[model samples]
Target: MSLTDTRCKGAKSQEKDYKMSDEKGLYMIVKITGAKWWRFDYSFDGKRKTLSLGTYPDISLKIARERRDEYRRMVATGIDPSANRKASKLVESIEVKDSFKLIALEWLNVKKSEWVSSHYSKIEARLQRDIFPWIGDKSIIEIKPIEILNVLKRIQDRGSLETAHRAKSDISQIFRYAIQTDRAQNNPTIHLGGALKTPKEKHMASIVEPAQVGELLRQIESYEGTFIVRCALQLAPLVFVRPGELRQAQWKDINLETAEWRFKASKTHQDHIVPLSKQAVEILKAIQPYSGHGLYVFPGLRGDDRPMSNNAILSAFRRMGIEKEEMSGHGFRAMARTLLAERLRFPDGIIEHQLAHQVRDVHGRAYNRTSFLNDRKIMMQDWANYLDNLRKGEDVLPDGFTPLHSMQY
Candidate 1:
């Protein structure tokens, strides 16, 4: 018989479990442990199945009846309530996996092998600080271009235009990753081209004129700093390497006998060779007694375990009364690049190769790091001699180094 309210209220637990049936396959299971649960039994496609409504008093008789009717309505329409429930759960799981923050983190893990530790940290930090709080929890497929622009606009409002541009690029990469992985339909950031104001480019201050460069070199020689810094300053112009590369130089990377300094280029992720000149060799030898035992060629003042701060050379420049508009530690590169091409008349390709720049060939292929090794070695020594002459205010037009106007390609 169908159940009623009085019968359910007076229902008692027996020695074993028993069920009180209701209309249309709905029933209540009563257990000896004093627990009661609502259950439904039905058939779909000629196969019988069961669905758990919920617990007894918590689901109550009235609610159980209502839910059972709802399921019966669905079953009458040729639907399987149990299968539909499972499908809904699967969709929820997929949604959680496809959230913007989770997918972005997945993309970051895939890129960790290609990026340096510092580069990875910067990307991670930017996402956490700027992107995560904005739309990180939203589904990647649902994120619109306007939402991303709002995040970038926040950064631009703070006057970090370049950072805003970078943040946009980073978001675009994440969205592209989502598209490739089939989690998203499109990259919202792709349509945002030319949306932000371009940041003004600021060139590193440098002394390009030969006469001014000569004066700058004379002052660097007289820098009143630590002995190791003095030696680094002396070698900076001769080698013209990036300041970070110079300060982080290790004795193991230098072969005194061969006059070569080899290390992986931080920006390009390739092996680079810096041909050491006689003057550069002398400076290295002089500093070896002090920093040779440590991992860094120029160890920090506080401890030998760490390399010198990248600002050491710049600070020395300031102390020498060289204004930021006049020269910087990186200025040595600009100075050498200018004079080498204009005064020394070296080919642009050879000079760019010596700078460890990623120059392309006529066919648009990148030249290898070690390209023109022999010519670079010759150029290194000649550049060193030229610096020596400049320090003494001597004529810079050395023989055998023809001007570009008179040379053939």
Candidate 2:
């Protein structure tokens, strides 16, 4: 029988527990103390489970029937109401799931494996330095396009337009990756290309002129920077290897007798042999006394095992009053590429090969190994002496020289 408020007074003093049906599966349990509670029973996967609805008048007969009927409707659709209830409660507990910061970190961790050590450091630095503090905590699914634009605008306001653009692209990639993995629903950066200001095109960097190269060589000769770095500056234009490969050079890779410094270029991560000139070997010999015992040919001042700081050579240029745009440590490669092929009339293939550049042939195949090594050995020596004589103000330009277009810079 259905119990009413009026009937409750008559049964209030009963000394035994009894049942009052709210619906088929849900009922009121009236206890010996005349206290009333609700209970629900259902089967899932052939196992019966009971759920506590509520106490007394709190879950009234009417409300208990409503909950019971809702559970029955869910069961009719082949869904387990009990499991859904548990899942809903668990989801409520984690209200911040699929957040931007969470997905970004997951993205970084997954991509970290594919990157080189230096690249990993650069990407990690970008995320930690710029993106994390702004919108990282927001749920990625909840973040709108305007919020992403706002963060990028803030980065531009701080005078880092390039970084802002890069960061925006990186963030877009993260979102896309997240979508692929089902961590996020949408990429906020898709519409950002039109909303953000377009970046100006940047030109390829090259030196000003061969004369300035001579002047810069003179400045390098006079630079009172770290002894190791002074050697690096002297060798930079002569060898014209990538800046990273130069810094990471080790003594084991060089044969002073054979005049060969063989190591893997960082960009290609492939073995390359630099046929050192007498001047280059001499420069190596000078630094060997200080760093011969250490792993790095140019060990840093602070540690024996560490490579010389990447900034040491560039800082030396700055100390010698070379402006950033006027010249750079990497600019020496430009200096050599221009002067050797244009001024000295070295073959194009020989200069590019000596530059350690990955040149693609007309058929899209790479250079046959050792195409320029023998010639480059002579060229490297001649290039060294040519710079030395020019620094001393000796007229070293070939007779009847009409400077080629590249020879100017």
Candidate 3:
């Protein structure tokens, strides 16, 4: 007979005794207070072993019989039930493999020290905001080109085509990192080159037309923004260096005695000498009261320690109702370039050298400074005077503006 409650009840009154049921090969051992623990005894590979089956009433006789049958099936299949159960638990606890988010984070961590803090923050923001939500849960190796294209398409749909293009570039870099680590076989982003909408051509530096440039300059002169920025706006076209270089200008870099401003260009990674025009020195002298005490030529509103943001001039342009294509902070360079070459009849080498163009020699490349400094110094003065005339609405002809034929030299 299988275990019956009457049989167990009749015999289990004597506590502290091991009770065996020959009919079912189960041992029902009773503790001193009359609690029953079940044990199953069996022979595996001619060796006898006992497996604990929990306490009685917790694991009922019917449940015990079902568990026994399950073990027997494992034996028939040449599987050890206990070993299989342990392995399954281990597999469940394991994290499977790295997800795209984990891999991307690791990728960022490894390269964090190589990048500036601002660049690090930019990459982190792009990855978290655009890339992570869609592919973070999936493994990096599993991501395909179509999925990446979908992400680009999503950013494009939001009318941020430039951002979409940046996201695509960043994602490609990330996948390339994954490939280097052997986590990914190949870059899926490679196939997605021409799949997305062609990026719209929006000039980073907006330059107004020669005819309208004077009007824009007048608007800048009359702009009623913060005094430091107003002075910066007016000085933009006079110097026409990169926006960062302009804002980060220090008093030490300026030689009022000689009317020359010298600083390192961050983009070209070279020393740049800007021959300050008489007009530029006047503007600087005008703004000296505000920025003279600070480290930067254009200090931020809240502090004297920090330089002004690059957007200060661009925002000023926006307030002047100048579209980005019509005028940007960097567009001043283009304005000076066009007017200097076409209107003022300056040499191409002088203009390019003043602009700090990288010239490749037989050995390598170098930024030539004094290649045409004399003509460039004069050209800068005339350009500054021309801008002043434009701001004053005087009759200034953009007459000497000509395309440079010797850009290669």
Candidate 4:
């Protein structure tokens, strides 16, 4: 039977600790010192476990039974109530300190594997330089929207509107993470969205006209640079991957026989596949004798351990008479996107996958890297053949397509 208040109050201390039984393994032990303690014993996974609910009078019979029922329900569902309680205590301890910096660092630690190293460094630097100095030690729960706005205003005050926007996003991310972890109730950054000034748009300079593209391809052939850089330049137009991804290409990620270069995309964190053309494969084969020993396809001049410097392609562009206003290392992507969309009239959905940009399925079904793999392989070969014809100064425009020479992108 459940212990009533009168009986529990009337129970006296025994010669030694003795039990006053209640229902469902809940009971009270009266010690020789007149101390009363409530406990619950239950079998879990074929092993018995005991839990100290609390002392009587301090806990009261009703509250102790309620806690017992709650914990029993947890165990019935295959949950370990003891381990769950310990985890709750840990979160509570962290919540008590409530340091925004501590929580933000926790968030970053959880997020480090998702972001590329370069992108992760930028985010860490932004938080350290802009947000941490002002409110690092402050309680995240108490940080008002106005306080967040002031921090963003300081970033904007220094003419960094873009950084201000990024800071706002970082703050929101932390607040949401805090909410998931039972720390913050609301996100302050959500209220300050329309308050900050929007930064101006910028697009990378690129040559998209077919004739100009042909001329640019011819100029690439005449490059008198290092053989490593030369091979990189040759493959750039064919693959049209981001400069960073191109330079950081690893040998293990490539399959020459299969004609594919697979890697994790730096921007979207997606498993991206770049189908290599015969020409691209040939360029890699040619450079294999020199750089095949290193980790990166394009190893830095300083050492074989490091990939080529970020500026290597930019410096090579300048030396080849390619001005920033005319074309950049990133411009190769824009060039490919334009020609593929306008000249080839390839489906934007297929092109988007090749560009490693996220696109949802029309039916909202699940899809993976190999989605539309055959079409992309065909497009890759077509693009390679197109570039070769352009470099040869041939007007090999396919009939029934948009005129390529007049339009500018």
Candidates arranged by lDDT, highest first: 4, 1, 2, 3
The TM-score, computed over Cα atoms with residue i paired to residue i, of candidate 1 is 0.69
Please give the CA lDDT of all the candidate structures.
0.83, 0.74, 0.73, 0.84
Model 1 lDDT tens row, 1-409 = 9888787778899999999999889999999997888899999767789999998778888999999998888676544667555534434344555678877776776577677466799999999899988988788888998999999999999999999999998999988876765567888888889989999987899998878877888997888899988888999998888888888888899999999999988677678899998899999999889888989899998899888887888888888998888888888899989988888878888888888888888899988877878778878888888888888887476545544434332
Clash count, candidate 4: 0
- Arrange candidates, best TM-score first: 4, 1, 2, 3
Per-residue lDDT, model 4, residue 254, is: 93
Ten contiguous residues minimizing lDDT sum, candidate 3: 85-94
- Leading candidate by lDDT: 4
Residue 210, model 1: lDDT of: 79
Model 3 accuracy (lDDT, Cα): 0.73
lDDT of 4 at 210: 88
Model 3 regions lying over 4 Å from their true place: 1-98, 106-122, 176-186, 204-211, 248-271, 314-326, 356-371, 392-409
How well is each residue in 161-267 modelled by candidate 3, as lDDT tens digits?
A: 88888888888887776665556788888898777788667566556466578788778778988888899987888888888788778887888878888877767
lDDT of 4 at 300: 89
Highest TM-score: which candidate?
Answer: 4
